[model samples]
Target chain A: MSALFGRSRSVLSRLVGALVVVLGVVTLTFFLARVVSPDPTNLYVSPQADQATRDQVRAMMGLDKPVLEQYVTYLGQLVRGDLGTSFSTGQPVRDDLLSRLPATLELATYSLIIGTLVGVVVGIVGAVRRGGILDHTGRFVTVAGLALPQFFVGLMLLWIFFVVLGIAPGPVGRLPVGLVDPPQTTGFVVIDALLSGQWAVAGAALQQLALPLITLAFAIFAPIARTVRTAMLEALDADYVRTATAMGLPQRTIHYRYALKNVLLPVLTMLAGVIGFAFSGAVLVEGVFAWPGIGQYALDAIQQSDFAAIQGFVLYAAVLYVVVYLLLDLLYARVDPRVRL
Target chain B: MSVALAEGNLLDVVDYRGGFRGPDGEVTEVLAGVSFGLRRSTLTAVVGETGSGKSLTALSVLGVQPRGFVRTGGRMLFDGEDLFAGGPRSFERVRGNRISLVFQDARAALNPVFTVGHQLIDVCRAHRRLGRKEAEQVVLDMLERVRIPDPLRRMRQYPHEFSGGMAQRVMLAMALVSEPELLVLDEPTTGLDVTIQADIMDLLVELISSSGLTACLITHDLGVVAQTCQDVVVMRSGTVREIATCEELFTAPRDEYTRDLLAASRLVEAR
Candidate 1:
């Protein structure tokens, strides 16, 4: 009974706690966006504009008021789902985010799925064959993979696949610049193309996505795979494993049913955190591949000092992290009933 | 003990030697020329201090010394057949079917995520030709045989929900669910308090003796040896220092180390 109530209570507390966190992130980013050089008015007005035009533009955005007043107004606007307008694109921030978000979401989701599967399988093999050549080589590869920066890896992949081999599609964007995209029903070309039976468009989009997805997977896979290996190694050394082995239970039973069950909580926690890091890596990867995902959009916004766009990006990222964490905590409770208490 | 030794021995480990090699290839001996035998349907205790490799001696009988530990030379004859003579498949047949092992920490031996009942059912069905429902029934019956109350409710509860005594009872039930001929208990009551330990030991002795099951009890507690075992094997530094009837060992210990152990045991009991 407590486990049932405890599950709901835990989720409620986590969600409520995330509200405070989100508020903090909003307030901090809001103030920081104002304080940072490259004023919002500078982006708005022409260099040759008079002071009157500059003051008028500032007043129009409610930027002439006190910092605290501006913050309050921003919060009020946020409650109404208004992230203000992008200085560069002159579009509502929320709509822009909603449109761009699916691309980053699709990329990160696929990469995480691929990364987690590859990591867990290799991690298990490495751990079960501990101290062997496979384990040693896996350790070396994971260490090198983790140590290398995501941008450098993305650039290398792009260079090899595009410049050296000429097998990959050009890094211009998701689809060929002149080719008509399938439809904007999903905002994601792959999904929209598949839904409309536009196989050619889907194939081309995937071809463009292939390298970035691989790069993102590699970026996330190192941490997740290493964690699985280390956790599995420790779990195999646990007393229960020895007991199972002594019971003459088959190796698969001991490895999968017993050791894997125990190792999954830590692995899940690490896995949940990796998606955030992977999405962040998407920013650089998107730039290298010229993929117009939220990451690239956010980068362009940052470069242009598009305050509203930056706020939405930061807020979107924070919410994603909180949701992932909450989902993982629920998974933890599901796996180990003790967590419910 | 002598009667069964003169007859067909249940298990005979002759001149067993084993050691582990480090990554640097340095060999450190854990068990050196240890030999003992288990009489069919009799309970025996292997008593030793820490680092004595008494537990290793028991493991070697099952052909499962820890990894990286090589068998220097040995023969483990179980039921007239050499266990090491055949491959792991041979041991696999014996394990959980012919011989079962219960460890020191019962809670630690059970997987944390699984209910005691769930694990017991798996252990029951692993070796036996039983469906899930039949296996569950066998587990419930075994839990009762170990004298655990509320077998139905307890089955649905995780290891953390069990008391130390309850957990050991569950361990015993799991070990005995498959009806193995030989039970190897590795300090089965080491983590429990004195009262719970005594209760667990009492339950174990009652179960093993009534069923006429042969068992090897590996423990540092002389009290366990004094109360539960019919025969005793005193181990020191990886070798069997003495093997005798429980009466003979307590009454007339020959080795100086055995005498010292007895003195220490008596002092602990006095405290």
Candidate 2:
């Protein structure tokens, strides 16, 4: 019972910590947006517009009030789940994020899954065949993959597959421009299409996703494979691995079950950091692919000086990172029993 | 050792040579033609200094030597079968089936991720082809034999949860659960408290006598040798300097090095 209470208390503390981080991001972004610009109203209002129009816009945005008052008001609205309105689209920022978040998440999630699978397999193979040809080749490829810039890789892949070879789809949006979207249940085009039994639309969605997915997955998997290889090498030399081998366990069992289990926690912790990098990299990937995700939304907001939208995006990302790290900690406790005690 | 006398031995390591390979492929030999024999149902101690290659010799027999170690020329014969000639397959058949090894730093030797029971069950299942239930029973029985309190609950705990002495007991339980014909203990009491060391040594002696298991102990502790082992192989600088019955070595002291080792240990004991 005490253990149960302790666990719940820890979870509560983590949740509180996550909220604090989100709040800090919100406050910082708010002031930075306010301080960096000349005036938000000038970006919205034309020079041709009269002084009356500018004054009305400023009052409507609560800019006429004190900064502290505006902050308190913003905080109050955030508590009710409102992110104010975007100046460019004139839509609530929350609604805009809700529409686009699924695309970003779908792209990031698929990339992470693919990256982790390929990386782990390549890592284990390299470790097992250490100093052999395959090991050397794997190390070279992963190092190259990590060294190349993500945007350049995306452009190069596009040049080869789309522009020159004409094998892949063009750098269009998530689907063909004229294709009507499936009902926005979860907002993810592929998943919603699949749910609504729209196989062709889902297939088209995946086809459009191919290059960006490859670009992002390559960027993510390179670091993962390198880290896993190093960790596996160390784990393979651990005394426990020797003990397992001495027990006459099969070679495969010793390598995978004993040595691999020891490296999982470290790999998982690295993945949390990788996911954060992926989220930030999504902005460039989304721009390259012209995918209708929050990365594009964020880019447009920044160009248009939509302060509310920018603030919301930063806050959303902060919350996401905190949640991802929290989940990984729980997983660590599961994988390494020492963590539980 | 004469061939006629070695005929009754369970393991006859003849002129075994092994060493670590350099990065440029040169071999720096550490165990140069070290030979020994283990008679059935007798406890033999290989006493040596820190750099004397005793632990490497034990690891060589199991075919689990650390990476980069090259076997230049050797023959490790178990029950008259040349293990080196038969390759890894032969070592696989012998390890944890006919022979088991226990090392120092038991906590580091047990995988921290696995429950103690899980590790023991794997050892039991590997050699005997037992079902899950039978394997669990075997593990519990061995844990009980090792005098671990509350075998059922304790088995579910991880290695880090156990004290150092408890971990050693668990390691012993793991080795013994297979019912191997030979047990090689490599400084199994080092790093443990002196009192805990005594307890583990006593348990080892009891287990060896009760099961009639032929055993080899590798340690630098002469006191442990005098108390538990019946025969002694004194090693220095990658070679055996002396081999005698424990009584003969303690009473007559054939080699200068053996006599010096005894004197040093005795001085420590007296102090």
lDDT of 1 at B78: 90
lDDT, residue A101, candidate 2? 77
Candidate 1 docking band: medium
Summarize candidate 2's per-residue lDDT along A1-341 as a digit string, tens digits: 99999998998888888888888888999888889983788887898999999999999888999898989999999999999898889899999998887788888888999988888888888988999998999899899888998778989999999999998999898897778889888777899999999999999998898999999899888888998999999999999988988888878888889888988978999899889866643788888888778888998888888888898888888887898898998889889998862
- After aligning candidate 2 to the native by TM-score, how far in Å is the CA of A89 from where it should be? 1.4
lDDT of 1 by residue, A47-113 (tens): 9999999989988988789888888889999999998888788899988887777778778888999
Per-residue lDDT of candidate 1, residues B77-131 (tens digit): 8998888889777787898788998877788778888888878887877888899
Highest DockQ model number: 2
Each model's iRMS: 1.5, 0.8
Query: Which ranges in model 2 have alpha carbons more than 4 Å from their true place?
Result: A47-56, A194-199, A277-281, B1-5, B267-271
Q: How well is candidate 1 docked (DockQ)?
A: 0.62
List TM-score per model, in order: 0.95, 0.95
Error of 2 at A121 (Å): 1.4
